[model samples]
Target chain A: MRADYLILGNSAAGVSAAEAIRATDSCGSIVIASPEPHRVYGRPLISYLLEGKTSLERIGYKNADFYERLNIEPFLGPGYDAMRLDANAHRATFSNGTEIEYGRCLIATGSIPFTPPIEGLDEAQNVTPFLTLDNALKAQELADRARAAAHAEGRESRAIVIGAGLIGLKAAEAISHSVDRVMVLELAPRILPAVLDAEGARLLQGMLARHGIECRPGVSAQKILVDGGTAHGALLTDGTEEPCDFIVAAVGVRPNTAFAVEAGATQGRGLVCGPDLQTSLPDVYAAGDVVQVRDALDGTERPLALWPNAVRQGMIAGRHMADDPLAPVFDGSFAVNAVDFFEASLLTAGLINPPDNAEGVTCDVRIDEAAGTYAKFVVRDGKLAGYILLNRPDNAGIYTWLIEHETQLDTIDPALFDSAPLNCDFDKTMRWERLHAGYPADRNEKGFLVKRECPSAS
Target chain B: MKRIYAIEAWCLGCKRCEIACKTQHSATRDTVKALTQEQPSPTSRVQVEGDRFLSLAVNCRHCAQPKCVKGCISGAMQKDPASGLVTSDPAKCVGCRTCVSMCPFGCVQVVSVEGRDIALKCDLCTEDGCIPGEPACVAACPNGALVYWESEE
Candidate 1:
């Protein structure tokens, strides 16, 4: 089989790239393949499903006729996943032993959970990594059974979630709806260490306690206590045992780049790609959680495993591969993440925790624990480096826009940290230009705002 | 495609657009009733910024490359290819507020109704057949501060 464009994943990056290609090359033969059996659905919404916030029907990113409207053929299911890539020969081999010749291809296989080596975890039952839809479904089923067993025996049914990262905590919160007790164990001293600082994590810990979920930091499972092939408890490294019925191992995720590496794609941290998002190979491009791009702020190469970055890279890759010579290149990305647990919401972007007392780096922060609000602004030189806002979502994007544009401090209001930002918060000229013309009208290919002489100033 | 643009010169910061926007999306669809009687009062998607001397009513630009659509984790936010209109489904939002954080214009808003949070944004005032093909915010502007028209670009 031969295809003009063959995409390897069906999640955010793959679907975005397909849309970009279909936008211009309407008649090209496009084929998308995935390891998952289900149609294209929001991968992040799987946790919301367990929490009863979303249903299967609503989780779909597009309408029912998405595939039909685009006129693309899809090879989906467990065996259809890309098994090997012969980049030199322009052929990709699938697990089902089928090879397809492609004019151009995309590697958006995303990432899988990197489960840590815990003694006897491989032989234990009801042990799964929280990454795929199947894992979420299995977790829901296990929670139901644990709930029933706890009622029958008149004891507390417990679930221990390893790795207090974003996925681990979301899994704990989602399963708490069905199970009686959920305990999160983390090797790090603070929860959500990657996104939140120690102060914010401490606040989140107190908030999670209200939902009856306990968090044990500075501890991890030394061994999985199995009884009759089922995980009954977890033996902690601190010489303590926590009784549990189900376990979610969500330690971390690594780029699924083995297939591309076997095909001799140059990799560092992840499958290295150019500014145009193309690999070293002639026609192959890499994107999503599987490729490393330069970090805009720190100027380091790392996989920005976030949804927005994946979507942006996909569009850049699609346009570049679809014969658009002047297409926009992949601008470096900084994190903009929002995680909510029940009523509490936290938004963090860029460098949340910078080096202590770095030259020309200053931090401004405000915390009102009574109202559960925390706002921190980390400024480097004259630009907005990063910020963390908790329980405040109003006009939060203004700060993000500033960070993206690297707006100077002279124009920014000092009161912005205490109140919701408004268009008036900016200088009069900027307020008029943005509200009148809209964005991307004046933005250059690299996403910087091109300054123009203000139209006679308001 | 027609888009709503704010004329900062004429905006008086009267906020009539805000009131009209809320009433149009409200359950009662009446200005007085929706404002006074509706519990958890409906929020206007358009925002009035600045003072009477210089102000603008900021609405969703619905850009060609919408960052909100790209950042939406639940796949709830989408842009209509035919009309270039960007909107989000409330049923699938899950209230993560990722869209709210990513939209540079700060037009997307989140409202909590009966303990469940969902995203609320300007759908061009096209939802529920309100004013057929017109925008209530643009229509209610007394000073002609708002205009809905196609650009020559």
Candidate 2:
């Protein structure tokens, strides 16, 4: 198959790229290939399904006619086993025994959940990695069975989730309502060690505990205790055995960059991309969870595996591929995490906790444990390096905007942190500009803000 | 695409725009009835924000790149392609307040009716066969503080 644009993977990034391409170049033939049969759906909503907060029908990110509306051909089912890219010919050959010639191509295969090499884990039937929709469905079925068994035995259904990261916590939260008990195991000293500081983690752990979810920090699962080819529990490093009928392994995710690496794309944690999201190979681009871009907080290049970043990168990749004059230059990417755990909403942006030894790194923390509110601001050289807002997360966009724009902290009104940052918090000139300026009108000629077309206008 | 623009200097802070917006969005079109109805008070999407010197009637800017829509997980919040209007579908909204947190302008709010919560924002008064060009808030502005018109690029 020959097309003007060939996109691999059909999740957030791939769908976004295809939609972006269709926006500028309506005549171009865009083909999206994915192993999943269904059209694009929000991956994060899978947990909501387990929690019964949302139904499968409402989980779809786009409407049923999304692909039809965009007029993009979809090649679904059968994962792309192999990819051979001919840089000179601008052609890609997939393992499905098909060759496609394209003007531009994008790789947005996203990531796969990492399951640790725990003894008996691979052989256990009840252990599943909670990442994809299939995994969620399978886990849900297992949970149902476990619940039924527990009911019949007049006992509580216990579930073990390894890793206290975002996914694990979400999984635990989702199944907590359905199961009798949920235990979260983490190797780190605190929960959400990557995103939350020690204080922030402690607050979240307390909230989790209040909701009856057990959190074991600084403990690792030594082995999955299996009986008759089924996982019944796990042996912890601390020599404790927890009974669990179902287990969810959500340690972390590694970029699915085997195709790009095989195609000679240089990778460091993820496929390395230029400012335009182009890979080392000609006519090849990478975005979403599979690409490493410059971090806005620090200068280091790394993979920012977040939904907003993926969508932004994908849109940029599409614009670049289509040769749109308005193609946005990726100024830099940073990590932003927003989640709700037991009615406590948390928003973390940029570097939550910079190393104590790092020069000029200062932190301002406010903790109201009784009210379940914690706000921490990490700053360096009069600029906001990062912030973590718990419970009172109103108007977090202002802080995120400041961090993204690298606005000097001194320039902003001090009253911002006191209350949720509002239009009144900004200087008069900035307030006027933000209020009057049309979307994207305030963006500069280049860098991050550029090429961010209004979803409607595009 | 036409959008509501705030003329900060002209705003009298009479809060008439807020009242008009609430009535238009309420179940009843009557201003007195909407405000006085028992349980689930009417909400005004437009706000007169400022002290004495300068007050701007602020509503949804209907951003070109709406962070609210992007942050919305339930796909409840959407920017209409043809109209360039950002609106929220209350039925689909899970009231996660993700949009409320992400909206830079602080336009999206979580409004509770009885015990159920839904995201309430300016929908440009498009419901119930309201005229396309006429928004209740913009029309009720006595001064030329708020205007709904197409901006020249």
Candidate 3:
């Protein structure tokens, strides 16, 4: 098939690209290829699937006729796989021996779970990874099976979740509600090592403990021991064999950019895409997890696999590919993950890493272990550099806006942070200023006077 | 050229004007059945005051650039071609509530009564059969709160 714009991958990045293309060029011929069997489903809601809070049908991001309404051809597949991107020919070859030609193409292939090799890992039957909807369903099945087995035998069930990252912790929480015991094993010194600092992680560890899930830090699974063709237990690096009914691998993921490499697009940490998401080839572009774009804050190029970034990048790339270029909406992508784990909300933005030379920088932090609230702010050059708000997140929105808008310290009273809600009501003028920023017209139009109308005026 | 006017002052808290609006718009031609029947009572396009204690009537202002009509996703809300009044067809509305959320004045109320979502607001009761020169609200108001007048040059 030939089209004006050919898009690969059908999740956030791919679908957003399709919408952007249609918005820019209404009549352009578009062909989208997806490896997944169904419509785009919100990835964030996949976690809620474990608790039976939602069903597969409720999770669809777009409706059934979304593609039809957009006037785009959807090569949605259970089998349609993109094997190679022939950039020179402006075509892609699928594993099923189907070739699609395009005017311009985008690679939003997203990412796949990076399951590291452990001893006897292949023999495990119920080993599941929490990445796709299928994986979530399969993990739920295994969890239910283990629970049923325990109930039948009048015994307690155990579920081992490897990697105490976002996915691992969430999965462990979900399983803990149904199973007898859920243990989260993390190799890092602290849980949520990448996103949260030591103090933040400690707070989260306590929260998880309250939820009845065992949070183990600085412990690595050395091997998975199978007995009778089933995963019997796992051996920790510390020489401990913990008996478990099922194992969930939520270690992490790497960008799926093999197609980019095969297509001869310049590859480094990921497919090297310009600010426009364009690859080395003329008509080819890469986005989402598979492409490395410069970070706006530090200028360091990183693979941003976050769903929000992917959607923004894909939309920008799609509009550019449609021959209607707007000012590149996404220069690179900001890194922000707002997650709620077992009712404890966590919002982390920017790099948590402080500069090596912290001599001149001033950091203010307040930690309330009892309330499970942790707030930290780094002020560099009189501007907010990084922020971390956990549990008690009422001020999260204000802090996030400050970080995004680069609000200076001069405008804010240092005492405003003292209030639990971050309200500036203590200072009338400051409160008015903050409220005016949110609604400019109300103050500007009305001023400090009320107009009086006579009864006959109506 | 009768102008739709809302009385901000001397307005009673009762929603009789809203009821009168539904009575005028209902195809049933009977007020008792329309008011008492549980199944799909005719919805007045008018909304009672959002702030309950200090009550006021909220209706479309019929602005030059009506935001409710502009914000409608399914093209259900539209300005009358000749009358220049912002109106919505219940048939075309998919009940997305985008208009309700977007309206700055909180003039639109999206109520899910009888298991179907619909927007309620005031349409001046223009289509409701009227006598030669009087609006239903102006006549119904015991305190003479609502007034209808034409703009004079």
lDDT tens digits, residues A1-458, model 2? Answer: 69999998888789888988998999999999877777787787788778766678877888789889999998887755336777678887777778888888899989887767889989888988988888899889988999999999999999999999999999999888888899999999999998899988888898899898999999989999998999999899999998898999999999888767876889987888888889998889988999987787787877888777788888889999988899989777788777887688888888887887789888888888788899999888888889999887766877877777777877677887876777766777787777776533543312123555468854
Ranking by lDDT: 1, 2, 3
Q: Write the per-residue lDDT of candidate 1 for residues A139-180, one digit (tens) a residue.
A: 999999999998899997889899899899999999999888
lDDT: the better of candidates 1 and 3: 1
- What lDDT score is found at residue B46 in candidate 3? 56
Docking quality category of candidate 2 according to DockQ thresholds: acceptable
In the order shown, the candidates' DockQ scores are 0.50, 0.38, 0.04
Off by over 4 Å in 2: A79-99, A438-458, B52-54, B112-117, B128-133
lDDT of 2 by residue, B73-111 (tens): 677788877777788876566667767757778787776
Model 3, A1-458: lDDT tens digits are: 78888988888788878988898899989888887777777665567666654466656666568899999898878656789888888889887888999899998888888888888666788889888888888888888999999889898898999999988987887788788898889999999887888888888888888888888899978999898778978999899899988999988888887877877888877888777788888899877778887776567887977766776677678878876745375576456666667667676766566776775566778887677688877777777666677865433445544556666777676764553323331243543343222232222222322544458955
lDDT of 2: 0.82
Cα misplacement distance, residue A366 of candidate 2 (Å): 2.1
lDDT, residue A306, model 3: 71
Model 3 accuracy (lDDT, Cα): 0.70
